[model samples]
Target: MRTLIPTLLFFVLASHCHGQVERDKALHFLGGNLFGLAGAGIAKQASDGNRIWTFVGSVAGSTLIGLAKETVDAGQRENGWDNDDLAATVLGGVTIGVTIDLFSKKDDKRRLRGRYSKLDLKKKKQFLQPTSEFVVLEGKLPSLNTLGLSNQQFVVE
Candidate 1:
């Protein structure tokens, strides 16, 4: 019974939060992008209004979800119940949830890093492109952040 309670708790949480990957991804993206946008939004608000509270909310939600899943996983391990699919499914769901949320928000301004980066595109250019038009490439990471990006634009018009 030592492990059973935690297992059940995890199950309940997961069941209630099933198919959350989009939401999780959305939240992840939203939280990451907030730093850029908050400067314009919260700058004029009262002292109590800042980006910190939204950030805290995102952290608590994501952490609680991970902790619940991990706790059940640990309990299951004690019984030798190896279920990789369940673990993977939960993670996938959370990721999808975050992704959905991230893209759902409207942002007039988005940061485009490294002009030569293939993924970087003008907002209008991206809108006209179909989803399947992307060209994936394998690349090695540069050794250091100090390196300057090539001036030629790699992204297709």
Candidate 2:
């Protein structure tokens, strides 16, 4: 619930959003989103969870790809370079980068770590101790008398 605000704000504040919802622009946005997400993941791994590097990587990757795409389009006769498309792409990248940054709080990590530590201790204690009341009987079935049901009747087909 708390994370939804930034996402909604990003869509509202995206650049060059002049009520022109073309398929080409949508595709550019999607492509930028994929590239940005990939970049953020790679950067997070390379930087060992550095927040700034992850955001930079996402924006940089999307911008680079958007530029390359526009350059290619400029070379073609039918599809010329469109600034709006590039803006959409960059916006997608920024959206993802900001989302990652917001979610990756150090305090959240610390809280999770503390919770997991307690859980780990409990798990270790459970594994190290054994209950004497429970017994394992492999390949053998308990008779009615052993089960404390001596008066029970059984029918076999």
Candidate 3:
């Protein structure tokens, strides 16, 4: 009975700690998404070469961030069941990040914002837009535009 009490206390503490880490990681991913959005446009604007490099660097940065995220996730997994907090954080961050990129267009930010605002992430296994040409005024979404679609949906892995 004495040993069992201590074991219960230890588990309670461990679970609390794990929950905190998971929450933190989710927030971090959400932040990264916002950062990526802003930086991606600036990178694109610098110069064609610089733009390419920026994207490359951003991808690397994102990968590193994901690694960091997974490490944090492992901790939570060790404690208890997976929670939605992590996904919420990543999605929140990505929404802001992608929006930042979308809004960066000098001429078409307003116009695009109107169309962009109409998009809904709730769709499953679908591309965001049916036709995506001119996502921004001048910028490109080759996949969206060439395919003549706007909204794109993604399958959750």
Highest TM-score: give the candidate number. Answer: 2
User: For residues 1-157, what per-residue lDDT tens digits would candidate 1 score against the true structure?
Assistant: 9999999999999887767645544443444344323322222122122334333433444444444545675778464333343344334434433443354343343321112123322234524655654333466544333246553544457
lDDT of the candidates, in the order given: 0.41, 0.76, 0.50
lDDT of 3: 0.50
The candidates, ranked best first by TM-score, are 2, 3, 1
Residue-level lDDT of model 3, residues 39-100, one tens digit each, is 44444434332424445434444544555566676779464323354454345545544544
lDDT of the structure predicted as candidate 1? 0.41
**Candidate 2: count of backbone clashes, pairs at least 3 residues apart or interchain:** 0
Off by over 4 Å in 1: 1-49, 78-157
lDDT of 2 by residue, 1-157 (tens): 6879988887787745646688888888888898998877767666656678888889988999999999999999999999999999998898888987776555544311112112232233434576567444786766667768854477465
- Residue 1 in model 1: lDDT: 100
Of the candidates numbered 1 and 2, which has the greater TM-score value? 2
Off by over 4 Å in 2: 1-20, 105-157
Candidate 2 matches the true fold with a TM-score of 0.56
Better of 1 and 2 by lDDT: 2
